[model samples]
Target: MLDQDTPHAAMPGLEIPESVAAALSGWVQQVAEQTAGPVRAALEQLESEAAELRDTGAELEAARDQALAASSEHQAEIERLTVELRDARKLATEALVSKAKDQLAIDGKDRQLADLRTQLERNVAAQGSESDARLAAEMELVGATTARDNFEAEVRTLRGQLDKSYAERSALRAELETLRGKK
Candidate 1:
């Protein structure tokens, strides 16, 4: 080990001339400068890549937020559609019930028409056998004819009612179909 205060005797018996020392120092500096340029460029490129990654992360976060908001809106729309569908189904059911009631009434009217026809036929057959009963039979026939005409008119009115009910039912069915198609 050499004394800290001594310069020329720093290393024993090792003398370096000023000119050769200066040349070695210059070569070391040149080598350091060359290597530092590539190192600084690599550091700058790394920093640029890191900044890009941060931007990508932020964009991904924003996309996730938008998707969540869209999903929430779609869920709300689905709930609203479900309520509308239920209402349409209820209306369809009520229309079907009304149609059934109208059908029953028409059936009753048909039965009444059949009974009136049978009675008229029996009255006509009775009038053919006896002269004394013939006059009474003609009066009975007239009354039966009037009753038949009234019943026929009532049948026509009931048929009109049934037709109106059918129309209403058709309208309800069409509305239901429209609602379903929206889904």
Candidate 2:
């Protein structure tokens, strides 16, 4: 029991009534007993929630790592495919150029063949003209041959006349010689 007559120990900046202090002490003890069970239960619930949060954080980190790895692999694949596509495009361009060159060569050959055909036609026409000239010359030669045959027959007749005259003159000379001898 506290002595009322003695100086009571006072908290700094607080006045206490005897009856109120006794009632406050009783209230503090009653509240401590009443709240102990619920407080322990609330602390346990908080601890469980914290543990679950830690586990969820670890799982989230693993998921993030897996996603990053998949993304990196996908990027690598995209790069490889891009290179392949570039090579294919290059090959296609070369093939197109080659085909164009081949087509140009074929066109050039066709033009040459056309020119040759034109030259051949001109040559054939020239040959035909030569053949016509030869045929005309042959006809002229045949007419000349007939004229030559007629001229040769006339020359033979003239030679026969000369031979007859020569024989008459020889007979006259012989008669003159016989008369002289008789005289």
Error of 2 at 115 (Å): 2.3
TM-score, candidate number 1? 0.48
Candidate 1, backbone clash total: 0
For residues 1-183, write the lDDT of model 2, one tens digit per residue. Answer: 988898988768867998999999999999998999899999999999999978876766665566556556555655665565555555555655654565565466556556656675877765555455445555555555554555555445544544554454455445545434443
Error of 1 at 22 (Å): 5.6
Per-model TM-score, in order, reads: 0.48, 0.50
List candidate 1 stretches off by more than 4 Å.
1-25, 119-183
Clashes per model (N, Cα, C within 3 A): 0, 0
Model 1, span 61-174: residue lDDT tens: 665566555556555655555555555555555555554554465456556555655665778764343344444445555655565555556555555555554555455456
Please report, in order, the local distance difference test score of every candidate based on alpha carbons.
0.61, 0.61
In terms of lDDT, the best-performing candidate is: 2
